[model samples]
Target: MTAGAIAAEPLGVACPMDLGWRYASGAAMERFLAGLRERRIEALRCDGCGRRYLPPRPLCGDCRLPLDRWVPVAAAGTLEAWSVYRLPILDGRTGEPRPTPYGIGLVRLDGADTTINHLLAETDPGRLRIGLRVRAVWREELRGALDDILHFEVAR
Candidate 1:
């Protein structure tokens, strides 16, 4: 059979899949998450560019240098960019649809050079702005995860 005939044939196979899996948060991220459990924020600082990464990474994106310096970051940050979503979206953590009319933003936390995208507590477009100050709203029970911060609210 010619290659064209083979390509036209249906390629179907029966197989079972296991959707469950485990993810290993590396040393940098592990340390970052540990800080969250303690209600503290930390970032990895790159010596070359002097840029601090919120979700501490092994290497700097710009300098490509191994990041080993740890620095404290404020829970409060500036809303650099934002959008208000009117439709319900699936929450990855809970696997449920989040209530409609929610806000999300790229926040540049104090002491960090990069921005971290997170859910915003404010849904009002008129109230949201680029330079608006926001602070993390932590869950009553602290968990060593990004979701430990329920959301960020406008810092009054």
Candidate 2:
């Protein structure tokens, strides 16, 4: 036994993880994504407080009440916040690191009470600002996933 810190060989092996699993997006989210596939936007309206939730959930977080009211939300919205990633980040879908200098934004859609977080097409900070108008750019072939929205671009 050596004096001071005697590091033991770490008992571990490095290997690529290849696994698959299924998860439920739940009823509310299922409906929401379905709308996206059709290039439609919808939100859950709270009966108690009247707050509309994007990425519709089963209940209102503020009132703790069941949210079943589906209301049409505008395709365009006001940008409430934004960020530019100067560092490359891993793409969760591809499991690969993607080049950076991309923009992301929080948008408060008209007629909706809450903001939806999504990627922004405008990477130039000079072109991005709070309250900038943005609209979803849909894919040519729509799949019922959030990425069906290519990204929100600054509306002309």
lDDT winner among the candidates? Answer: 1
lDDT, candidate 1, 69-114, per-residue tens: 9999999999999999888877765678978888999999998989
Pairs in clash, predicted candidate 1? none
Candidate with best TM-score: 2
Give per-residue CA lDDT, model 2, range 3-109, as digits (tens).
55777775888897667779899999998898988998999999999998887988888899999999999989999999987888776767899878899999998
Clash pairs (backbone) in predicted model 2: none
Q: What TM-score does candidate 2 get on C-alpha atoms?
A: 0.89
Cα error, residue 124 of model 2, in Å, equals 0.8
Positional deviation of 49 in candidate 1, in angstroms?
A: 0.4
State TM-scores per candidate. Answer: 0.85, 0.89
Q: How many residue pairs clash in each candidate?
A: 0, 0
